[model samples]
Target: MRNLIFLFFIVLAISVTSCRKDFSTIPSFGQLEFSRDTVYLDTVFTNIGSATYNLKVYNRSNKDITIPTIGLERGNSSNYRLNVDGIPGKTFDNIDILARDSIFIFVETTVDVTSVPDPLYTDRILFDNGTNQQDVDLVTLVQDATFIFPGRDPISMEIDQLTLDGEPTAIQGRFLEDSELIFTNARPYVVYGYAAVPANKTLVIDAGARIHFHDNSGLIIDRDASLKVNGTLNEKVVFEGDRLEHVFSNVPGQWGTIWMREGSKENEIHHAEIKNAIIGVLVDATTSSTPTLTLKNTQVYNHSNFGILGRGTSILGENVVVGSAGEASFAGTVGGSYDFTHSTFANYWNNGIRALPAVLVNNFFTFTNDQGQEVIEPRDLTQANFINCIIDGNNNVEFIPDRVDGATFNFNVSNSMIKFNDINGSFTGVAELDFTDTNLYQNITLNGFADFRNTSANDFIIGQASDAIGLGDPTAAAQVPMDILGVIRTLNPDLGAYQHISF
Candidate 1:
């Protein structure tokens, strides 16, 4: 009797183990739930891979279910790639999930224009088989670009280089043809090398046109050439690096600059967003009586160096916001003519050791002569006028006026909020920051808290308690009828690029 009882116990244990091994293979019908029914991957350039997105496949039932098949409806011909539950393939079979558990389906795409029918690429991720099949739609807008790169001399395989800043650097570049000079929104332009606009030519970028550049590539306006970026409030022209990956989104120095060479004439940038560059707009030697670059309702930010570096150039900027640069946000160096109204120059650069201020006005620069001796050359700053503007930065003093007595340092700041604190007389010796002198500065609030809506995120919009509200010169505000966003400014408007907008 004892032996029979022991054998019965052993058999019961074995039966329980066998029952545990028997997992329910019956596929759960209509039991699968997804985080989203559709996934939109947004816009990506042709022949480039898009950022990976994920779809959560949930088993909401009480019993474990095995999806017999999970595959793209388009099969192997589809441009979209998928990875199901850690397995990468176009088709997956028997993907298992525990009760109340979920699995992730990763989706990515690198599509060629020729392989896709329409710019709006669409595909579906189908789950299960036959009647109980459920699917999630995958859609992405693919854009075909007119790629501009230097052509090699078929015999020599040599490309042209650019003589930038008196240094000849080997760069893959070519002059733009007449047909390519007029950029439109019909198709984006992805430039791999520098696109030089020849002398006497003009490159007009229409509103909503997207211009993407590769690393170290930029647009060069030769002598007598021009660049007119006609952007609007709703649709602004975008100039950025071609690295569409999320990692490069806010990075600085991704590309070169919109270099308006010494004699480039009548270059105008309006309602444009120029970002992620070494120098946003490098205006060189514009000595015209009229403004060389008329920047209106434009934003040039996230530059590694100066946002708008005017080396003896003339600029008349209105409703401009320049933010976050390794050096100064707006540098009028070696003297230049600059008149900024309703503009904001805020530098909250925590990237590195930023020694310069937000706005730098200097009248001279030191350079080595042929004999290797340091020679200071005078470049008279005819005018560095800031009216109804907000110039603030993380530093105690955001405005720097480095003047050489021999050269002229003509600057006027009226009805503006500046961050200048010289309690220690660090900058008080300079006449520009001497609050006692009304000729150089007037009605300027020193070290006034801008009360920015969000400084950490580079949002310069002011709040109710901010000192910038109603601090603008009504006369200057009348000139810039509208703010950067096209909002009609009141007679007594707030400072900065944007008008005082309440939430």
Candidate 2:
């Protein structure tokens, strides 16, 4: 037994010695290859952490190599953090790699505005030491802007409360000040929480203004408040997520919606682009006789839920485009007055299976009341008119009218291209259910092939061979003389928002 133990100890010692020989001690100069010389980390707002970016350090030589040190040039005081071979640290020592093998160097940053000299923060990743030292540039464009987040009490950090749907909810938000009412294009605005426009106030976004919201953050227009976006053709206002990386450009559900709450009025959005949100614009309650919202030459795309959700509200949209939503691209819910002219509502959502249609009109909603009983609310759909529009999607049926009896459901879809087939008998287009009558749905083509410029990439521009071309009412063209692109429309204009521009 003693002899066997001695032999086992000797074998273990030899194994440990052999394992140590895997790395080479030979010093190398200018032989290390990298996947990228300059790693561009994602752009981040002030004091916000960025996503981790990786760099591959390859050992191309035949022999194994040992990197004595791997660190940031800023040393311990650096804002950037590095991770080498799964070990998180600001600096790593004695990192070894086999021949033709590679190791990953992950880097992340969370910089404060006071730490950097300028908004463009730059650093270097130093590898090795002495005469053979090498480095790779690390650049991050840090943006400094006005951050509107939920303000809390300094002592207890207690958030404010807002009444939502008759329920008092704790929210991280505050009403806008007079100074903050006008958002400019000087710097990007980053919102951490809901930014509310109080009653009797108007928040105006200037041309070329870019507003980025963090997850679940959005703009809220309160009762009697207004939100007017003054964007132009050349410089459109952009509302999207805070992530500035290319990978996150079309990602859905990155943020919340521009919520126009009950009694909110006179909201106008023109030449604006809103994307990657759960719900693009949610307009609730039409308290006044005037239209609650007016959308012109605007795009609300890449939403997880409805692009435009109007709950008993009045909306007038022209030359608008709503694209790629998991639910209906435009949902006139619980009855509303909706008018869309020369607009395109297309949902080619390929990310997941979509069960709903692109355009949904409903006159009622069923919900449970506080008494624990199911309650149904009947809302009168005053009007839902679509003129010279394209309501199409990848699905066979892209339009659905969910109307309950007893409620007034009045709608007209004239000279439009719609995708609706009643093969399943779900919507038979009988009486008040759908707009199938010739008088109500006049000159409309049902399930016509759109032949769009590119459906996959969310381009709804119609081709020359499309059935929508030259189908617009000549009288309608005279009403709205220009298209979304500011192009003059002919007297007998093409259908949809773009007027069939040449590809």
Residue 423's C-alpha lDDT in candidate 1? 62
- Candidates in order, TM-scores: namely 0.80, 0.90
lDDT of 1 by residue, 1-503 (tens): 99999999999999999657456655858669999999988678888788889999999888888899999999999999999988899999888888889999999998887777798999999998778999999998888887887653323324666565457878667788898889998878887678899889999999999999878889999888999999999989999988776667889998999998898999999899999999999998875798888999998888998888988889999999999899999999989899999999999988898989999989998899999999998879999999989999888878888888788889998888888875677764566668658898888887787887876667888877788888877777888888998878867688888876665
What's model 2's overall lDDT?
Answer: 0.87
lDDT at residue 349 of model 1 (Cα atoms): 85
Query: For residues 1-503, could you state the per-residue lDDT of candidate 2 as single tens digits?
Result: 99999999999999999777644455555589999999998788778888889999998998777888899999999889999988999988888888789999999999897777888898899999888898999999888877776663233323655565556776666677798899999989887778889889999999999999988789999988999999999889999999987678889999999999989989999999999999999999886888999999998899998899999999999999999999889999988899999999999998899998999898997899999999878899999999999999988889877778878888888999898876788766466445557867889888887888988778888877789888998788788889888888866688888877567
Query: Which pairs of residues have clashing backbones in candidate 2?
Result: 150-172, 150-173
Which number leads on TM-score?
2
Cα deviation at 139, candidate 1, in Å, is 2.1
Instruction: Give the poorly placed runs of model 1, Cα more than 4 Å off.
Output: 1-37, 55-70, 83-88, 92-105, 113-115, 126-136, 152-168, 233-235, 243-251, 350-353, 367-378, 422-428, 456-458, 486-490
